[model samples]
Target chain A: MNPLAEIVAITAVCVLSGCLGSLLGLGGGTFVVPILTLAFGLDMRLAIGASVISVVAGSAAASPRYLDEGFANLRVAVALEVATVSGAIAGALLAGHLSTRALYTVFGVVLAVSAVQMLRHRQDRDGLAVPDDPIADALSLHGTGTGTTVRDIRPYRVTRTATGLTMMTAAGAISGLLGIGSGAMKVPAMDLAMRLPIKVSTATSNLMIGVTGAASAVVYLQRGDVVPLLAGAVALGTVVGARIGSRLLAVVPAGALRVIFLVVLLIVSVQMLLRGLA
Target chain B: MKAAPGAPEAGARQVALVLRIGGGLGAALVLAGLAVSFAESGGGWLHGSGVDPLGGDATMRLSDLIGGLRHGRAGAIVLLGAIVLAATPAAGVVTAGYTWLRARRAWLAGVAVVVLLLLVLAATLGATE
Candidate 1:
């Protein structure tokens, strides 16, 4: 392929993926890897490498905007990081010992379960009365959503802290073992388990995904999986797309976001199941 | 229990500042590297010359980046940009930790430290792989 064409093509794909990634808190790898491999005919390793860079780029670029908008919960992010990072470390340690196919199968089932749960609670809004967990109380994870265009202010409380943390651990472990960001897992955990606002869940997941990606990106870099020109094109494109997506989040209704997330979740679940079976 | 007035806002601002700086620098470097590659290829880089003009060598270590920079390798410059981009979130985490400490939230600050340590561990594990 012509160097220029390659750069242009990859950038275009990244722009679309980055937009969706930031909008949905997915980090874009779920889309980028498959598109590069199946559509563009790129090497899988190369695609994963580029996906990692793109995920970091999209997450990092959009995060500041989310923070400014008060959609991202920093307290929740920090509290959950303890669980996700520990899961990631454990998964990394057990990476070689476990079977990828089996992990995929299990993760697919988990996603399916999460999708069902999300659907069942689609109408549930934040600021609802719920029993509080001791950990959430201690960490002060509850907050009032400010700086959002959707409402003047919506105060929300955290619940089922232990469940959310457990889900985060599993999410992190999946990412560590599969070398994916697994934002799909993070958003659902926050929204369904911790009972955070959907926007807050998405935005905070956006921020957290970048932090998790930073760790494995080094491995990809050292292993020579990252092609500089290719990954650079991806990084550049995702940043631009993420900026656009972040602005869109202020207007995109939470109900609509939930629908989009469900579609993405189902698609990802089926894809993982197929891969595992294959 | 409630936090100090505007504590979350203050923390968010600090984290945002770090992210903007890191993300901006990374994007600029990537753009610059692309420009250099275009210049080296004399506009044929994007137009499809028979030879690949922008192929970058895979760098194995940080030291390799310095060496590549001395040679003005476009790929290395881009790789460095990507690495910086990847590192931005971790930097944000560190900044958040500092913010937590300033708020006198020892537990949250300690959580930040543990997160950082885990990140380093994950990186080290990857490096060994």
Candidate 2:
């Protein structure tokens, strides 16, 4: 692909990815990474660097609405960052020693797992039950459970706090290692492990991803994996796409979209795994 | 119980505000760089070898990038834009930390500071390499 054509192509695909990712409450990095490595023929390392830029771009763009609308929990976000940020740095350091093929293999596994999780789509109406965790109480992590879009805000007690942190650490490491936003891991850690409401977990994951991506982004930048023109185009496309996607989410019936996205992810995951093997 | 406006929610709003301004500025600069690049290169964007994202030859020091901008190099400007975009979230994190402080949440403030330090450390590490 012509270098400029590559930028233009990635930008176009990223716009669609950003739009759909935001609409589904999945950060855009998943789509961004595959497109760069597969379509643009960028090395896995360079692709990760560019993908993180788009993830941060989309987060910065859509976060205002998610936060202001009461979908995200700030206390939880801050609490989790201590684990995620540290893990991201660790993952980044490890990336230096790991070979290109090793990174690709890991990326394939992550994509496959994320695809299955997305298809599952946790039941929405599970009653909120707040657990008795002293750490959560000390940190004031127990949220008031006032929702903006989901209207039925139930303040739930946290459970398995330590496990949640452990999962978050892994998520952060995967994020830094793969150059993804790590929402796939973070969301489950918060939603299933910690028992946060799905809405809060998803939105908070969006907020956390930007910070996680930014942290490891410095590592990529230092290593010169970030191509400015390519990254800039991806960033531009993502921000624009996220803006449009967020607006559409209000009206769209997400059930159908979720099904469509599941099939797409499965195919992409398989392709990535094969590429890694090859 | 009907929910009242909370301090954390308010702090999040402020952080969101910072992100909007910082990200918008960064995106605008990048787009501007693209326009300039198109004009200077005269439709050669598609003809050059694919982007060398991890190549040493493509990497330049921050100082050199600034100097390149003076010479009207679009790539330099684009790089500046990227650097700004990368930092914008850290700025927001600091802002959030400050907000947590004002709200008298010391632990959250501490968390913010720690994350801020990590970001600085990461960037410093990048510069060294």
Report, for every candidate in turn, its global Cα lDDT versus the true structure. Answer: 0.76, 0.76
Residue range A73-174, candidate 2, lDDT tens digits? 877887787788888888887887788778877888998898778767576546555467877877777774543344555566667777888898998898
Q: Candidate 1, residues A1-278: lDDT per residue as tens digits?
A: 66677778888878877887898887877667666655666655566677777778888899998887678889888788888877766664564455656655655675676578668855535345798589888877888664234554667788998999888888877665555667878988888778877778888999988887776676667556677777788888889888888888766666786687678778877876776678
> How many angstroms is the interface RMSD of candidate 2?
4.4
DockQ of 2: 0.45
Off by over 4 Å in 2: A1-4, A121-128, A144-149, B1-8, B46-64
TM-score of each: 0.85, 0.90
| Top candidate, metric DockQ | 2
Clash pairs, model 2 backbone: A4-B45, A130-A156, A130-A157, A131-A157
Please state the CAPRI-style docking class of candidate 1. acceptable
Identify the leading candidate in terms of TM-score. 2
Model 1: DockQ against the native? Answer: 0.41
Best by lDDT: 2
lDDT of 2 by residue, B31-93 (tens): 998788778764555566444433335554455676878898887887788778778888888
lDDT of 2 at A209: 81
Prediction 1 global C-alpha lDDT: 0.76
